[model samples]
Target: MTAASPRIPSPLLLGVGLMLVAFNLRPALTTVGPLLAAIRMGTGLGTTGAAVLTMLPVLFLGIASVLGPRVSRWIGPDRGILLASAVVAAGLSLRALGGLVPLFAGACVAALGIGLAGVLIPGLVKREFPGQAGLMTGLYTMTLCLGAAAGAGLTVPLQDLFGGSWALALAAWALPAVLGTLAWAPFARPSRAPVAARSEVTRPVVWRSPLAWQVTGFMGLQSSLAYIMFGWVPLILHDRGLSAVDAGFVAALMSVGQAPAALLVPTFAARLRDQRGAALAIIGLTLATYLLVVFGPLWLVVPATLGHGFGLGGCFGLGLTIIVLRVRDAAGAAALSAMAQGVGYTIASLGPLGFGLAHEIGGGWVLPSTLFCALSLGAAAFSLGAGRNRQV
Candidate 1:
């Protein structure tokens, strides 16, 4: 008898695949932070060049996300994601080989893959697990946070383990990408039945919807803060006299807080009438955390890290959850997701680059910290409107 075909997909299998993919999404990005100082010194990149290095991937993410819908149409969700995972694997592997050009190029490639996956994964959840968007998104986001924390916390040790070769350490993350691609390949084949099919529309409904824009605003604002923390917190701590390893540990502490919030907040928010109160509270707490980071004594760093992380985890998960809740069908969800992330990431890309420039110009973290305060207040303002209970 012929060998049996691969086992048919089951919910448990799909869930595992989703978690694996989610786990892979952030390593390529987060690994850079722990190694930022090494990268700058090794490559002779000044602050501006370093900023560009950090910004390029996020910029590519924005640009790629904008094309997500078209790509989805071309390859279908299953193949599109498979292609993205392949890109991530190739990028991470290439980046590990050494040299500034390879480093930037590899990051851009991985970001492109991440961009496509970032847009499509939510739509996939909306379509496949229609009744469980909250739980799935929570699981997916929590895994994302866990992956990020692992990358940030481990890269330095990995570098040391490899005899202080940052290149090898960066390359190590590629393994998970390869594994994720393998885990996802079987499930990436297109399904026959389309999800939540709707009639063709003449205009882009999501673009014109106020609610869509508000959701996009929330996404952009929250992401701006998250990326800043990811891109600079280690460096910031290092500047404040902490050693690289210690800085990484502190950053990891912040990241650790994200996992629980990412796991729980979306599910909780889904049950609320208007998520405004919760959203505002999180933002307010985040602002307070920033203040502590900026001016509080070193002894307070642990709590500050935890508070900031919890805020980011809840805020980010809730932003994605809003996209799912604000729409009616999978089609709308896809459109909304693409728009929010496309425009949102495009806006958020500036945070790291801009803050990097601020530090360079001011020659210290104080000016940048002030700017972050303004950004925190602004994000809070936008969250007010975005958190309203209105469907797009």
Candidate 2:
């Protein structure tokens, strides 16, 4: 008798697993912003140290992403993701123990998990939902924004409920990580196909492609802006005289605003002949709205924050969509995804660091605002090339 074929997960199971995993990607990063003041007060972390604390996770995200392809090859994508989720749970749980060392260490570990999932998920989307890549990516991105909003919006309340313990509030995110890991567990069984058969016949060298570089540039620059929102925006608002609760509320609102755009932009972009126009429009919107939030009348900050969120969300959704659109096969998508996020996020980590340093040195938001503008313009320049209807 012939040997039995390995069982594959149903589409429903796969879809649920994918979204749950996506939902775990942003919480660890987002929770920090709302609690930064409390964390600093408790740990004596200065502004620069706070920046480093924020920047550390992103830096490690980039470093870990570069290893994604290799890990997938060795363990399979399903197993890799399972491992990633488990690591994230452990990291978040570690954060609950308190102290500077635990906080930073936990962030690094959780970020490594997030980075691994980030690189692999796109390729999985390409492989499993080839016809619906855009929609699926939109859903994935939307889920990420929702997770971010939850973390931003709920941390303070959780802290208050837990007798003012920021660490406990931060640790609460681990529950989602655990759920994601459990959801993905059924799919992590060993495959009947040989490992070699799962890989590309001829792997594309993504690092050498000019178009790939443009995509990476766009991803990096936009991600810098996104991380800035996660790491410093609330603090910036607080500095501008908003109460902590109000500042966190605005940050949460920004993240909530991202969800609709995140779900819509990639779907719309995919139907177009090219995404160039969409890219330009969103980048302009992001830059304009961000400036308004930083400098416009306080009465208008809420609306500006929402607009900024929509712009950033659309930019991020398009960035992921471009990666899928630029590749014709799953292997190519995996390679491109690795390049875009690996080098891209390394470039991204500098944004928070730059903002913090600029604030410290210039002693005001002017210098940080200048840096934001420069980064936004650079992203626009690269998006022009990345948005082309061409395969890498």
Please name the candidate that would achieve the greatest lDDT relative to the true structure.
Answer: 2
The sequence of per-residue lDDT tens digits that candidate 2 reaches over residues 242-357 is 98888989999999989999999999999998899999999999999999999999999999999999998999999999999998877778888888999999999999999999
Each candidate structure's TM-score, on Cα atoms with residue i matched to residue i, is: 0.95, 0.97
* Candidate 2 segments whose C-alpha is farther than 4 A from its true place: 191-204
lDDT of 1 at 392: 76
Error in Å for residue 189 of model 1: 1.7
What would the per-residue lDDT of candidate 1 be over residues 218-288, giving only the tens digit for each residue? 89878888888888889988877889998888888878888889979999998898888888888888878
Tell me each candidate's RMSD, in Å, in order.
2.8, 1.5
lDDT of 2 at 337: 87
Model 2 weakest lDDT span, ten residues long: 194-203
Q: Which portions of model 1 show Cα errors greater than 4 Å?
A: 1-8, 195-203
Backbone clashes counted, model 2? 0
lDDT of all predictions:
0.85, 0.91
